[model samples]
Target: MTAPLLVTGAAGFIGMHVCEQLLNRGLQVIGIDNLNDYYDVSLKEARLARLKKHKGFRFFLIDISDRDAVANLFKTEKPSRVIHLAAQAGVRYSLEHPHAYADSNLTGFVNILEGCRAVDAEHLVFASSSSVYGSNKKLPYSESDPVDHPISLYAATKKANELMAHSYAHLYGFPCTGLRFFTVYGPWGRPDMAYFGFTRAILAGETIKIFNHGDMQRDFTYIDDIVDGVLKVFDNPPEADEAGPAYRIYNIGNDHPERLGYFVETLENVLGVEAIKEMYPMQPGDVQSTHADLTKIRRDFGFSPTTSIEEGLKKFADWYRGYYKC
Candidate 1:
């Protein structure tokens, strides 16, 4: 029998989709999440409920930062592979609560590594973010680019996680892959994200804040594309490159950079309601633009994001209206 897969943050937006995809492929999945109120707790529960119906899925509510609980789960499950995705997300929120990032991103990730080391998990894949590219004027950020500077505490912790994972891969010869995702959006996305928030505000007849005077651009990747890229990486474990390590980092992005104004237009078109615009300077932790250099990921895993902004946003808006009864 094939060994079961362990997925941390299985209740989260991307995590839920990943778990569903794994189950559809006939893989046994073990999931863990703390079910924190960072967003709506009911939404998390709803995601979990879907997984609970599947006979192949087993879920435990545990925070990865708790070393003992996480270690116990690893020992008990003996999963063949681990996908670590739980973390304190949001850049502006990180400014107000820096310690959350430390506890979850740093401490939590450490416990995951220890668990993997103890159980000898065959492969470990974790989520990273484009925020780590931070303030780089470089148009398309690549894995090979230097990411020493981070604008927010959230970005810093993610970058640190990648470095820590690389160390483990080097020392233990464990296969580890880190995916640096661009702006991911679709159904079931975090409400704290700009796209989600903007939709809410615009619907409520409130002015949506357009930072950088609406000059920003982003590689808005669809959630399905992100999930497909992640699953592809999970299916194919990294081999030690001539660089002398089995660790790999890939930028999972749409490759199409669209302006903030264009994004808003797309959203407005989908909702069939014009947004009240409130232009503002870029926030302190905000970057002007983000573009992904996906050459390596494409070469490695045939990673191609096929969703266009118009189609993806339309689907998200349709789901949003139905879900919220708007």
Candidate 2:
């Protein structure tokens, strides 16, 4: 068996999926999450309940910002690798609760870093976001592209994570990989996401807001695809390359950017319902489009996102119906 892994935010949407994947591969996992009610605590608990069934999995209800708790976890578990997914997410929510972002994203991330350093983890993988490519207007955002200007505090935190990881990689000779995930959606997805909200509104026969008059586009990646990509990267850690900073950043996204209207239409079709559309101006801290350049990941690690939106939406709809008894 390989060395055990530590996954922060194990009860979260992405973290839960990652833990499941790890357990399925017969890997030992130690998951940690605060179970904060950023959304629904029940959903987070549900994710934890599923992970508990795996004998190879262990969980701790510790907030990442708790320095002592986080450090103690690393000392006890001694996990060789770490996947830091715990963060204060959501762009709009960041505007309302700015301090939450600092506490979770900044302070929490620092705690994770200190843990990784103390444990001398083999590789550290953390979540980043496409929001870091804020207002680029570029067709395909690449790791090589500059990401200095972040529109929202959430995006800024994500970008800061990359920088923080890079500094550690350089200073400690630690191998760190930062994944800038795109629009990840599917079963057990976050309720705050647009696709999730859209599904609920359409089902309730409520009008769904169409920002930018549906002019926006996103690389709506599936949760499974994201998990697969993450696992692949986890298996292959970046070494101290001469050019790359002993740290690597990959954009984990669907290379195909689908129109917002088209995505909503696909969801509606899967649900067998038409959504009441409400046209609106672009909200603050919102980007018009996001397209990822997957060349680096594809060439180096054979990373490819295979799920199309139609097929993905159908699966999501099925899971939603069964999960919610809709």
Candidate 3:
């Protein structure tokens, strides 16, 4: 038997799925999430319900922002590896609730770092986001690309996390791998996401807003692919590299940037309902496009996303219809 792994944000969309996979692999996992009502607590509860069924999965309802709580968890669990995914999400919401970002992404992350430092974990894998690229004109955002400018506070925190992890890895001898996840979507997804929201709006015949007049692009990755890449990276930690930083950062994306118009059309085809798109100019803290250059992850973890948007959206739509009884 191996040491139990500690996964923060275990009840989240990505977190729950990661925990499920780890548990299925016969690994002991202690999952933690504060269960904040960012969107709908019931949805989180539903995700947790599925995880609770696993014998190897243990859960703790605690917020990572609480330094004392996190330190105690680490001291008690003594997990050899840690996966930190808890953070205040959403770009537009970050503008309204900037402190939420600071509390969860900044202060909360400090607590997580302290926990890992205290325990002397073998490795720490955390979630970053494509938003860290900000408004870069680069076609495919690569790990080697500069991330000095972050348009949204949410993106800023993710960028800060990569820096924070690197500094911690440098000061201490622990290995850290940070993953910049692209637009992840699938069953049990976050309601605030465009794909999820589009599904709901299209079902309810509500008008869906199309930013930048449907001219945006995103490398929409599926949840399973994200989980697969994460686990592969977790099993391997960053070591001495020539060009990369003291810590490693990789992009886990579909490597296929889909146009917003096409993505919506795919959704419409999947749900069998045309969307009422309200075209508008770009909103603040929003980017025109996001394309992930997956060379690093591919070479490192053999990460290849197989789910096409059509197939993935069909699964999401079917799940949504059944879950909502629509």
Best by lDDT: 1
Candidate 3 matches the true fold with a TM-score of 0.98
lDDT (10s digit) by residue, model 3, range 76-99: 889999999999999999989999
Better of 1 and 2 by lDDT: 1
Model 1 pairs in collision? none
**In candidate 1, what are the lDDT values of residues 123-168, reduced to their tens digit?**
9999999999999987899888989999999999999999999999
TM-score of candidate 1 to 2 decimals: 0.98
| Model 1: ten consecutive residues of lowest lDDT | 237-246
Q: What is the C-alpha RMSD of each candidate to the true structure, in Å?
A: 0.9, 1.1, 1.2
lDDT scores of the candidates, listed in order: 0.93, 0.92, 0.92
Which whole-number lDDT from 0 to 100 does residue 174 have in model 2? 75
lDDT of 2 by residue, 267-325 (tens): 98999999999999999999998999999889888988899899999999998888888
Per-model clash counts, in order, read 0, 0, 0
